[model samples]
Target: RGPQSQFTRAGVPAGFRSHPGSTHLNYMINFWSDRTPLHEAAFQGRLLHLRALIAQGFHVDTVTMDGVTPLHEACLGGRYACAKFLLDNGANAMAVSTDGATPLFNSCSSGSAACLKLILQHSASIHTTYQLASPIHEAAKKDHRECLELLLSRGAQIDLELPDVGTPLYSACMARAAACVEVLLYSGADVQIGCGPDSPLHAAVLGGGADVVHLLLDFGADGCRRNAEAKTPLDLSKPNSSVRAALLSRGPCSLSQLCRLRIRRSLGKSRLHRASSLFVPHSIKDFLLYQ
Candidate 1:
C-alpha cells in the first residue's frame, strides 16, 4: 500500500484528508498532539494555508514532542511572512523548544535579522538559551554580525555564561568569527572571561584567528595570562604563525588606552551608547565608548 493508503485504512478523520495535494498528506500522516497541520503550514511558509488551518481551530501555541511551535518553525525556516502572521495572531514569542532554544534563538540561527528584530519588538528575552548557549552565542557561532549587533543594541548581555559555553566573546573566538570578535570587543566584552581557564585571547589563538588576536590585544586582553594548561596566547598560537608574532611584539598598552578602558568600564555596558555624546574628541570618544 502507498503512504496514503495506510492513513485512510487507519480511519483518520475524512476532514483531515480533504486539504488536497502533497502538502496535506506530507504532514497529516505524521500528526500527533505534538505537531498538527498548522505547524506544517507555518514550517512550509504557507500563509494562506496556515490562516485556513487556524480558522479551522488549530491552536496557535500547539507544541510538538520537541516543544516546537509553528512560530519556531517559521523562524527556523526564515519565513518572516509566516512568522509575523503567527505573531500577529498571538503566537507566544517566548515559547522555548524542548532543548531550551527560544524562537529568537531559532531566528538568529536562521540569520534573519528581520525575524530577530520582529521578535525583539515583541519583547522576547534576549537571554533565552539552548542549554548554556544564548542567542548572541548562536549568532557569533553562525557568524551573523547583524544579528549579533541587533542583540547587543537591545542590551543583550555580552558576558552571559552557560554551564560550558563561557561568554559570547569566547564563543566567537573559538569559532574564528573575526567580525563577531570585533563587534563583541567594541560592545565591551571582557577579554579576561573564558571557557574554564582559556580566555578569549587563548581561544582566538587556538582557533588560528590572527585578526581576532590583534583585535583582542587592541581591546587589552592579557596575552601573558596563563590558562589551566599553563598556555598563554602565544603558546596556543600555531607555530611560526603571524598570531604568535603579534602576541610576541606586543607591549603593555599605552596610558591613553588604559584610561579609555577604565572609562568604558566605569560607564558599564548598558550606558555605552551615550559615550558618543561626550565632549571629548571623536577619536577619544571612539576609543572610550567602543565606537
Candidate 2:
C-alpha cells in the first residue's frame, strides 16, 4: 500500500497530506505519517517495512516539509535500519538540508552514536558546516563527548573552524563543556585562535568556566591576547570578581602581561583620542574635558 493509504488504515487524521504547504509542518507530517512508520520499524530493528518501502519505489531521497530528507531524520532519530534501507535505495548520504546540514550533522547534534556510525559508514563529510557551525562544534557545544570521540576516530577535523570563525574547542569553551574542550585540545585543536572578539580563554572567562580557563592556560593559550575592543580576557573578567580571582590565581606574570597589553592598547587608544581631538573645535574639547 502507498504511504498515504497506510496512514489512512492506521487511523491517521484526515486532511493530513504527505506534502504540505508549510515546509516545517510537511517535514513533521512526512515523518510522523509516512516516514515515521519506516523510522519506527527501523528503531524496532526491523527491516521488513523498510524493504517494502524500497519495493514500492519510495524515493529514499524524498525531502520533508522543511527540506530535511528522510535520511536526516532517520539519522537524528537513530533509526539504523531505516538509514541503511535508504542508503541501499540510492539515498544520497551527503545530501544537505535547507540549512546546509547533513545527516552526519544531525546525528552529532542529536548525540546519536548509532546514527553517527551509519552516516560515517557512507563517508559523510566530517567538515560540513551547518548554520555557521560544524558538527564537531555542535557536539562540543552540547557536551556530547562520546559523539566527539566517534567523530574524531572517523577523522573529523579537530580544529575545523566554522563560518562564524569559531572552532570546536572555542564553542566548547563558550558553552563551558570542559570535558569536550579537553577532548578537542588532546585532539590538537588550536586554543589561541580568536572567534570574533574572544579566544577560547576569553570565552571560558566570559562563560564563567574557570576550570576551562585553567585548562586553556595549561595548554598554552595566550592570556595577553587583546580582542577587537582592546579588552584583554582579564579586563572582561573584572565584572565577575570570582572569575577575576580565578584569573589572578593563575599567577603574577599572566596578570602583568595582561596589564602591559592593556596599557599598550590604552596608549594606542590615546593616540587615536589625540588625533580625533585635532578635528574637534578647541572650545568643544575644553567643554568635554571639563565635563
**lDDT of predicted model 2:** 0.68
Clashing pairs in 1: 34-64
Question: Which lDDT tens digits does candidate 1 get at residues 1-291?
Answer: 012212245434232443544343323324543456667788789999989877755567766656778899898888999999999999999998767888899898989899999999899999863655479899987889999999988878888866678888998998999888888887778878978777989988888888888889888899889998998787777778988887888888899889887888888777777899988889887667655
The 10-residue segment with the lowest total lDDT in model 1: 1-10
Q: Compared with the true structure, what per-residue lDDT tens digits does model 2 show for residues 1-291?
A: 125324556444333444545322122344443444444444454577767654544455655444567677777766776777778777788988667788888788778887888888887788864646478877899898999999887777776666565878888998999999988765556668758656888888888888888878765677788887888889889664776777777654555445534433343422423533556677644432222
**Cα lDDT listed for each candidate:** 0.80, 0.68
Best by TM-score, which number?
Answer: 1
Q: Candidate 2's error at 194, in angstroms?
A: 2.8
TM-score of 2: 0.67
Q: lDDT, candidate 2, residue 32?
A: 40
